[model samples]
Target chain A: MDLFGQYVVNGLMLGTVYALVAVGFTLFFGVLDVIKFSHGDVLMVGAFTGFTAASGAAALGFSHPLAQLAATVVFALAGTAALGAAIARWLILPLKSAPRLNILLATLMLGTALRESVRLFYPDGSNPKAFPALLPTSSWQWGQFTLRADSSILVVTGVLVIVGLHLLINRTRLGLAIRAVAQDEETARTMGINYTLIVLVTFALGSSIAAVAGVMNGLYYNEINFGMGLLLGLIGFSAAIIGGLGNLYGAILGGFLFAALQMIGAVAMPFASAYKDVFAFAVVIALMAWKPTGLIPERASDRV
Target chain B: MDAAIEISGLHAAYDKADVLIDVSLTVAPGTITCLLGSNGAGKTTLIRAILGLTPPRAGSVKVFGAEVTGEATHRVIARGVACIPEGRRMFPKLTVAENLRLGAYQEPSEAEIKRRLAEVYDTFPRLAERRNQLAGTMSGGEQAMVSIGRGLMGKPRLLIVDEPSLGLSPLYVKENFRIIEGIRARGITVFLVEQNVHQTLAIADAGYVLSGGRVVAGGTAAELKSNAEFHAAYFG
Candidate 1:
């Protein structure tokens, strides 16, 4: 029973990271109707940004762990948000009238560029970098189960962020404008909502959220690589798809579901646990075939 | 007389195909001006050109005497123009209240938005009752009411209603026209585009008839009502 509880707790922690990444995908898809294939790379860049900020803070003698963490998150979010807005303005908006496939290919190529840049530009970025141990390293033992203090902190932070995001989306006027633009672009324009501004804001918001996930992943694993985003991005996209691509709640649910599947595979499979992704993907493929619209299909009328 | 919207010698196209050619019209402030045409007569295109959704190839479109020929649609809207686009494109998945709130996107204050929202609810009690309901779930007539209420939320100086009567029952059609007339009575200029010649003419101060991408006729609503040319062109 303790073993089961441990797996559940571990799965939930991992799921929170995936959920944050998946939410970005869902938000981008909700507003633009185009998948940003390069979002994973953006998260990688964010992690790198956080790494740089942490190093800079340490060098500047900001010795407090909390200060280092704060600096990392702030720099990562701001940098990634700016990058996202730039990409939307220069790359995505110009291709708005082009063929959908062309835009998809463009974003895919952009992702490759971003990945390569990090690998080539950063000093020895090809090697995995050790992330700072800024989080508390304490652990608690209850009965036969053990809980890490950092893991608990991450889970609480994730819940708070998600709840805050929900309020921002549901209770604010800007949120109302976003929903309007997402529902009908042309009508939104006639209603005095600026399309370009809203699209840029959406991209920034998604990118910043991915940055948070990136930093959290680094802290959780104690290491990050240039290629970490690739796998995480794929899993996040899968989570968004399984949960229902344009549905926010669905994205988070899909993340948890995927994590649970991996956990189950780790325990149930006869082979090594590395085969967990294979098991998860196989189940996702079958589930997708069964219900293409996902667990919570978007309620908007399908575009003709 | 001050014109609310004045278009002179306008030419517009869709890629290679021209949709409006040498079109000229005037909408006087505080009066309903109807643009009458058959299907494919470029009535929608004309509205698009005026709203800057489709930029005119050559012409001037002035709103309240300010030249705004190639401004973006949102900018035009910000300049006090609102549209009840064809099909009443009410963000179907959103609730009626959400749809109405979006109409006042440019409003400055939360209190002002609340005021406008309350005014809309008072104007359409049905919408008030169903404010929390998804817009697409409403009946066709009720949807039309929501669309009009949304336009009113903007407090627009000039409201362009494109086929508010389309797909509605005869009873709803009468109600829609009555509502349009009531809006005009409130001193808001209305640029109405429709194929329902008689009903549109009954409430319009002036009317223009378009055919084959050209304004073939223009006169007072009464003159167009009696003109044999309009009858042969439209009714027949």
Candidate 2:
């Protein structure tokens, strides 16, 4: 019973991060009508930025860890958002009317460039560096289970981010514009909405959200690496697709489900530990084949 | 009063195929101007050109005397030109309220937007009843109503409607034309494109008969209705 509870808690913690990442993927896909393949690497870059900023700031005699972490997240989000806008403006904009395949390849190349550049530039080529932990390492007893403060922080912060994002999308004028553009770009334009500005803002929103997930992952795992984003991004994207792309609630639901599956797979058959990636992929494929539109498919009329 | 819309020597093409060739027309304010033609007769292309969705290769399009030959779609729209585009391009996934709000995207104030929304719902009581309903799930006639209502929310000086009666039942067709007539009654100028010649001619203050990208005949609705050329082109 204790083991089961712990697994559930673990799954929930992992799910929240996945939700953040998946939301970014779903958001970009919703507005642009193109899968931004480089989204994951951008996340990895965000994590590195946070990690470097925090570590550098700490070395510069900033004793307060929480403040450093907060500053790191803010700077990382701003930096990654700029990078996202650049990607949209420079690489994706020219190929807007081109074939989907070309854009996919271009994004893929950009992801590769981002990942390889990080690895080459970092002191350790392939090895992971120790990511600084900001939250208290203390644990609390809940019935028969031991819950770490760090995991609790992760879960709370994740929920806040998701809720905040939900409000941003549903309530704000900018969100309405994004929804409008998503529905019909031409109609949106005819309504006096600027296409270029909307696209830039959308990219920035997605990238910054992805940065939040990246920072959380760095804090939770206490390690950072260039290749980290690719795995996390794939899983997050899978969750988004499974939940239904463009549906924000669906992404979060898909994230939790995905995390639960991973924990269950790891526990049910210890041998499955090595094949976790295989299991996740199989689940995504099966879900797609069974319900091609996704678990909570977005209505067709919302199409741009 | 300024001309609602004036296009001088307008030339436009769609992907290497010339759709509008040196077409020129001026819509008088506070009247309905109908562009009557059969399918593929460049009616939609003309609307698209005027809206700046497709740039004219030659000539000028002026909305209320403001020359907007190569302006962007948004700029054209900002100049008080609203289009109920062909096929009633309503955002399907959005609720009626959501769709209505989008219509007033350019409006500066929330209070003003809310007032306009109330005005829209008041005009289209059916839409008001289904404010929270998804737009795609609505009937074709209802969707058409929402589309027109959305355009009205923009408070455009010139309302361009393309094929509002397309794919609608006869009863709905009458209702749609009545709505346009109501807009005209309210002193909003209309540039209407339609294949339903008899009814469109009946409501129009003046009519332009377009065939093969040229205005073959132009006169008061009564005059066009009596023309042998109009009858030969459409009725024959």
Candidate 3:
């Protein structure tokens, strides 16, 4: 691939990961009007859980890489989903009558606790763990263009995950219930929709998607760390806000835009590439000032 | 026949302050029973008590003679009660068809659901024309139509309408009351909770006046209308 193509490919992968995370944020916000701030830490936990499961699979004599990956991904999804549900059930729901800021603070602290637990307790958890190289490392090359098999797989899987989520949100009864709850919980109840169940399901769904992104991030980078979710979470949240907090399409758009901005920043200044986040965030600030609602603007129903 | 709604010695509270204090009323089967009240009159509380949204702290509530106090809201709704809530809460992002479909959420048979949906569309031909449009994007009058049509889609035994005329012009208010009269004419009981005393008493067979968490008055529509003292305070 040409230099531009390489950047595009790299941005696509990064954007997919960010989009997945942002989708979770948007979904959680849509249903409950609260940000699951610990979402990033949940992603980190999911990655670690997958890592542990992969090792367990190895010890159990499952030598096939694909089988190991499957086990890892499943464990990641199941683990994060449980944690997410617990948070929704025990933490979020109980605090429903409390101020909104309390939920934000509680989730933020929870994120910190998760990060510290992983760092302090995971047996050298503070160090960057080596993520398994399960996918084929072969690359297709033509002239100045090249595409790695693992990258392509990651990209395709991410895209498929997004498509699946879209179908689940738009094509099913569960999706309708979620949207209804989002609009008006009391009204939804009058329609025979269980408000608590939808909230739990939404958190589980969002967390599981984060888990997938966690596993993919590990695979793409060949490394994992306890603090990985911290920056990723902030980036994902920013993406969701830029796209419109309660909008799914906005989340996706925000994710890709954030990624694209980072890519451009890197291209503009190769020697100080670490400052890319600063550049991207600065652009975001400008963008927000220009369009306070979001790039797409929240879908407004006629008021009054 | 069992009263569609029966609430007696009802006491409901938000936190510690009672919203409905010793409230007693009955909504007869197949009749429009208006709960006439101003803001903070506990009318919404009474409706919530029936729907199990706010279960009475001390009361007996029977919907078709089945005790439903403190039951889950959905369960209460499943017993054939539909609420057109205050402010016309629409799943604004959802389409007209989707909103109506949710009203029949417990219906097991898709064919039956479609039949009822068709019936709702038949009643509100405007909703049928704009079935695909997002309900929130519509005019307030049209949104009211969607809300009422949604209530009818459930094929409920009793419909609880909470302030259907909220934020609407006089024309829409008259239009809504006419549609509500149409709903009662279909043999479904209506618990019409409203502040618009004149319009409510016009179509109501019976009504109650709630104030400061108590039943201030209860009478047939004709009696309440003819009572000079009652007319001076509320009918104006």
- Between candidates 1 and 2, the DockQ winner: 1
For candidate 2, list the clashing residue pairs, or say none. Answer: A183-A304, A301-B92, A301-B93, A302-B93
User: For candidate 2, lDDT tens digit of each residue in A124-233?
Assistant: 75789788888899999878888889888888988998998788777887887888888788887877787789999989888988888898888888988999989988
Ranking by lDDT: 3, 1, 2
lDDT by residue for model 2 over B12-109, one digit each (tens)?
Answer: 88787888788888899888999999988899888878888888899898889899888888888898888888888888888888888887888889
Residue clash pairs of candidate 3: A1-A144, A1-A145, A1-A146
Cα RMSD, each candidate:
1.8, 2.3, 2.6
Poorly placed runs, candidate 2 (over 4 Å): A1-3, A59-61, A122-127, A270-272, A300-304, B227-232
lDDT of 1 by residue, B1-236 (tens): 65899999999889989899999999889989999999999999999998888889999999998889999888889888999999999989888998898888889888998999998888889999999998999998899989999999999999999988899999999999999999999889999999998899999999899987998888999899888888777777
Which residue runs does candidate 3 get wrong by more than 4 Å? A301-304, B15-17, B167-175, B226-236
Preferred candidate (lDDT higher): 1 or 3: 3
- Model 3 chain A scores worst on lDDT over the 10 consecutive residues at A295-304
Pairs that collide, model 1:
none
lDDT of candidate 3 at residue B111, scale 0 to 100: 97
Return the lDDT, model 1, position B138: 92
Shift in Å, residue A113, candidate 1 = 0.8
lDDT of 1 by residue, A1-304 (tens): 7888878878988899889889888888878888888899999999999999999999999999999999999999999999999999999889988987887889889988999999999999889999998899999999988888998898788877777777777778777777777788888888988889999998999999989889989998889999988988999999999999988889999999999999988987897888999999999999999989989888654211
Q: What is the TM-score of chain B alone in each candidate?
A: 0.97, 0.97, 0.96
